[model samples]
Target: MTSAALPPSASVTVRVPAKINLELLVGPPGADGYHPLATVFHAVNLFDEVTVTAAEEWGLSVSGPQSLGVPVDGTNLAAKAAQALAERAGVDEPVHIAIRKDIPVAGGMAGGSADAAATLVACDHLWGLGTTKQELEEIAGGLGSDVAFLLSGGTAMGSGRGEILAPVLARGTYHWVLALSEGGLSTPAVYAECDRLRGSVAVPDPVPTPEMMQALRSGDARALGAALQNDLQAAALSLMPALTDVIDAGLEFGAVGGIVSGSGPTVAFLCEDTESALDLAVALTASGAVQDVRRATGPAHGAHVIGGPRPG
Candidate 1:
């Protein structure tokens, strides 16, 4: 945002990390059909980078190992983000956005949200709009629940449909083994399934997990692992029962803790250290229960410019 003097033809690139819900507490759906969440969000090494450049007309392209199924049209969240920002800033200049995806698509890891957050940062600098952080947060909150957290990663408390955020003091780095599945899970479908499973049961308000917060503060992986909880887990498992085998494999491999990441087919295993993560990853892969495994470390920084504006 400091590069407001850059030429109109300049381009900017921003890298944003993927998020995992370490503890997702879901409340009854509110009037808006959005669940109230009191959750712990942890940003990990999985990332998606988005670059923006001035163009004669709006355009989008995507590439990367995870790029196969991602949309390249206006329906994409990144595209919607550009349109939103352009309207908000009262600028009509078109931008060509290039997204290099590394985060798993539709894995309940919020990869699409990450791209939208990256687009906001990239377009803000590329356009030399000098938009304030508060304004960006407001825009992000409208884009999606996880978009705001992608803008200010690390550990945070996610409330109000996961849009409102506050930083959490997490003391140490945590290693994770992510078990990826062959197909993605539809987030909406999972939520619908959750409601169906509840079946008129009184789903009360979500509250804090003091033990989880304390474990994070003390940097105790074991305690944190033991405290990992997700209300959507039951629904996720119900929709994709195959995921249970993956979770069991992680625990059997001696992971300190394992849970379905977000609304997941991607199971995240909390390990004691880097070595433990590698070992667990190998074990899960060898078990043939998961399509792939990625070893990642948590508490990564959020989205920001990796490339400053440069003249075309």
Candidate 2:
């Protein structure tokens, strides 16, 4: 007897969360010209949704509030991810990707990386590649340093150019108020500035403080807030002096702690609780220190398929 024909593959959608650095320590540039880093990555609720559908031709489109700056071509990380997966799987099928972004573009939130992570998961499911998580993580690491962490999300420690990952044990959620700048800062530029500012000084090996780890272990938001640190803050502030004003404004509004989010123009203000986050968001918005303010909670899940599969 003949077997029945298999059903067509279904489309897949993956939602990925944005990230903030709880502790970002930057060491000297390596022989590869990339800085060595030891950082704590915390995934927040701000998310980007990536949808993959099999198509006759590979194409990418972006929508949503922060989508204007994203490239729709192969240069886009999401596209690169899909291409990489296809190449790895030896699949010739073309796929169409639609990114619905809420994460700030190039704002040190790893928005692009999030999309790439989501695409990897989505396309893998859509194409029935059955790629293992380890295989997907390897592809993610090749795409970007932050992409690997985005694939896992939650709380993790990153080293070796921020691709090496170790899960962090943390107890409670952390509330934050993000102040979005009018224009995003270029990460490469920020790193260059950091190099320049550290000229003549011996860069030390970057390491996260024990206190930060302890705070997370205890689930003490106040302690965590006090322990928040970013090595790139000085460089970011040097490049965008106005960011200092934003940080000051956040503190003035009773933020427990405020730091430049990675190589950022976006400022993240830590709050004691949800109420404090809301209050800070409102105050920062009213003060006009930032173009926009958003409230989010950290310790969110990584890229994952959302909703049930749909027929092709």
Best by lDDT: 1
| Per-residue lDDT of model 1, residues 242-265, tens digit only | 998888889999999999989998
lDDT of 2 by residue, 261-284 (tens): 999988999999999899898888
**Candidate 2 ranges with C-alpha deviation above 4 Å:** 1-9, 308-312
Query: Which sections of candidate 1 miss by over 4 Å?
Result: 1-9, 310-312
**Candidate 2 weakest ten by summed lDDT:** 1-10
Clashing pairs in 1: none
> What TM-score does structure 1 among the candidates reach?
0.96
TM-score of candidate 2 against the unseen true structure:
0.96
